[model samples]
Structures are given as structure tokens and as C-alpha cells.
Target: MPSTSTSLSPLSTGLARATAGLNLCHENASEVWHQRPPLDFLQIHPEHLIQEEGGTYRDQLDDLRHAYPIVLHGFGLSLGSCAPLDQDYLQLVKRVLKEHPEAFFSDHVSWSSLSHHHFHDLLPLVMNDETLDYLVERIDQAQELIGQPILLENISSYMRFRDSTYDEPSFINALTERTGAYVLMDVNNLWANAVNFGENPLTQLMEYRQSSVRGYHLAGCTRQQAGDGDVYIDYHGEAVHETVWDLYEKALRHFGPWPTLLEWENHVPPLERTLQEVSRITRYLNDLSVAPGAT
Candidate 1:
């Protein structure tokens, strides 16, 4: 049987205390239907769930929708691109949202396309005033078209732009302030960047300096030793690391809990193994949700 606990939103007090359950990728929908683990929600990638020939959604996902609440995580919104917003793609996304009006939508802060050509990766961005202004304008445009506010997630980057002005966290804080946007914090990504950039992960987050977390993302990345030193890759594969868990503990301690996600991007694990991971996370969340003050 599924746990009685429900997913917590940033607006909810419980979110501050943790207590949110597991949210898995749509690829695990079938497994979830069979196993019926205590899940909070299922995340659907827009890139994967395209419309059918009849202009309707893939009917197969209907079962998953009926089983659990869906949250839309976009890969191709390209809000960071210099090119104009892709109206056709946005319409498709809006249509899907209409089908599931209750679903929350989000995408990475990084650009995945340029000059109408997609790189298919969450490419890094410069955190200068120009980039900030560009992204804020596009976020406003995206929110207007989507008919709801959207969350922008921090993307893991291996390189930094020379033209960058403010730090990533500062830019995000300003971005949200300028556009009334929310954030989906990826702790692992921050940790990876910290490891690679020689900065403290907690300091990276604390610089945001506001409770701007609308959602949270957790995934594991492998570390490789290079000629220069060590570098961490945000591959979203493998099990969660203790260091990342420690960062998460600090995040929960400071910001409390928001709607958190466990991304099983590649090197997929079996359904049973995924279940064990979720159970472990749930126990941690349950322990943490009982914060300093509340019951």
C-alpha cells in the first residue's frame, strides 16, 4: 500500500519541515502501477510525451495520470535562448497542461537551444545583467503563455562564462525578484558545482538568501579525477552520495522541505531498487520533518 503522506508544496508549512514523499520519473509509471509504492507524484517530461497524429496526447499515459498527479518538467522550453519563444512548442505544452490543469510545470535555467537549433543539453549561461534581463523577460512571456507561474531549476555547469557578473545564486535571486518567478533547487547540481568550482555548496545556496525554493531535485553524479584535479558530473545516475545527502540535510535544516524530486536520468535501476531508495529518502524526510518547533 502507498503511504498516506502527500507531497508538500513550498506554500505549505510542512514543506519547511520536510515530510514529502517520493516523486519518480514517468518511465517508472508502469512499475509504480504494479508495485504501488507510497509515491507523492510522477514527473512527466514534455520531450517524451508529445502529441499523437490525432492531435491528442499519447493515450498510454492516461493510466498514469489517473493513478497519480503529474508534474511537467520541460527539456525544450528554451527560455534562455536569444531566439524568440517557440510558440508551437509552447502551445503543445499548454494543450497538455489543459488536459491536466493541476500539474505544475518547470524547466532548467540553462539554455538548450540557440538560433533555433537545439543542443539538447542544458547549456550554461552567463550570470551578467544582460543574461538576467533576457531570462526574466522570457520567463514572464512563458508564464503568460502557460497561464500559470513556472519554476526555473538551476542547471549543473562544468564551465563558467568570463563575462559573468554576479554568482549563480545571486542571479537566480534577482531573476525571481524581477519576474515573480520561483525556483526548483537541484542540491546535487550545486554540490557538483561546488566540488568542481572550489566553493561550499551550502554557501552557494545561502547566497540566494531567501526562501525562494518552490521545488527540490536530488540525483547522483559520479566523480572523476583529472589532470588538474577532480570533477563531478551531474549524470543523474547511480545512488545518492553521502555528501549530497549531507547537503540535503543542511538544505532541509535551513529552508525546510519543498516539493523534492529524485531524478533517475540514466543507468536506470530496477523498480525494487528504486523503491528501496525512496524508502530511504522517506525515512530521512520523516526524521527531518520533525523540525525544531513544529510537531
Candidate 2:
């Protein structure tokens, strides 16, 4: 049977103790396949592996599963859309999960579609009671269809709608409270928003519900010129910025150690460099685990 727990599944619970992992990407597949790194678990995008020639480890699901526990992180659910859930997309995800019922699933809280047209980008939602109600209904239906809870991730926002009634943290907490879903807190995205819009990461951490946050994502951003100032884009191309690491450490202190994944998709680096970043996450988690007053 598929996992139905609102909290972390058995595999995710075990991986939380393991501390760190990497987002499975085709660019690093050869090295990962030839010499399996010491990853706690692997996060895969179902869309990237739905076909035999999808280039995500070149259709080696069986071989990869033998080495590590898997988790599904999707990008096409478009949960924030006003339209009904995409049955075809859901079917592809269902097929993958049917084979690995032990895996947990996650997707962004932002919308990416308008009717039949897909934006191919994680667009921000207006944080209001109406939007929240809409998302709650959509998430409920999605959970029912998938037969498991999902971790709704915070996407990096370049701008905010003036009609927003609730801040990001409040909206996310309310979503989780209403739907019994978990939060895939992406610290890099938080930091990007902070850099772009003066949002305080420390304040957000305090405002967020710790119990709702079940996992984390760490990635790098690109700073580009915008108007007179600069904008920080969640590019995931370079190394983790120093400011992001600071925020990540603060998150660990706030939420305790959880399963964290390092995402390096753009300008994919060498496998060694990728593992090095994962090592940094492991180090942070280990430090937190051994800290004073730790559980």
C-alpha cells in the first residue's frame, strides 16, 4: 500500500537521520551510477523519468533504487491553478509511485499553468483567503488521487501582488494546517526573496510552523542587474552563497535537522563538487544533532 501519513514516511524518516542528499539529475548520472555517493536519499522529478529515454539516469530506476531511497519532486502539478487537476500528468506520477510506494512526494506551491497552456515557470500566487481556499481544495484532491500527503515547497518570488493579504509564511502555515500536508522549506528561495525584496529570513523562520516543515532544499542564486539595483534569481547554477549557508544554519536551529537536498541543475557541476555541497549540508546537520539541548 502507498504511504498515507501526513508526516514523513518511513523512508523519509530514515533519510532524515542520514541528513543530506542530492537532486538526481541526468548530467551527473554516469558518475552517480558508476560510483554511488553517500547520499541519504535521492529526489527525482517524475516528469524527468516518465519515459525510457527521459535522460534521468537513462532509465535506470531499478539500479538506482537498489542504492538509495527515492523521493518524487514534481514541477507540473500546477496546484495553484484554477483549473481541475491534470489527469494525464497525475497518471504518470501515479505509475512511478506505484512502483515505489515507500517514496514521499513534493511540488511547488506556486501555479504553472493557465487552462491548457503551461507557463513552464513557477509563478507566484496572490496570498489571500480566496487563493488559500482554492489551493486547499486542489491539494485535497491531489492527495486523494495520489493516496499520500505532499510537501508543498516555497518558490522564489521576484515580485509580490499588492492584493496579498497574508505573508508567505502565514499562507504556507495555513495551507499545511488546513490540508495536513508538509512544507519542503527551500532556504535558498527564502534568501533570494530576502535579497530581492528585503524579506527577513530570521523573521520568516520564527513565523513558520516547525512541525509543518518536513524537509529542506539548498541551492545557489544568480544576481543580475534590474533597474538601478540587482535581483537575485533562483538559478541553481553556482555554489551555495555564504548568506544562504547562514540562513540554512539558522533554519537547522529553528526546525531541527531534517532531510535536506542540494539542487544543482543549471550549469551542472562536477559530481565531486556536487557531493562537496551535500557534505556541507551533512556537516551542518551533524553539528545541530550534537548541539547542546539537542534531542
- All candidates' lDDT scores? 0.73, 0.82
Find the candidate with the highest lDDT and give its number: 2
Write one digit per residue (lDDT tens) for candidate 2, span 16-130.
4436888877677677888887788888887776555744465565578657887889998899887889887777777777777557789998999886788868999999998
Total residue pair clashes for candidate 1:
2
Which residue segments of model 1 deviate by more than 4 Å? Answer: 1-29, 51-60
In model 2, which runs have C-alpha deviations exceeding 4 angstroms?
1-14, 51-56
Best by TM-score: 2
Span of 10 residues, lowest total lDDT, candidate 1: 1-10
Task: Tell me the TM-score of model 2.
Answer: 0.91
Model 1 agreement with the true structure over 150-214: per-residue lDDT tens digits: 78888989999899998888888887776666788888998999889999888898877556777
Lowest-lDDT window of 10 residues in candidate 2? 1-10
TM, every model = 0.86, 0.91
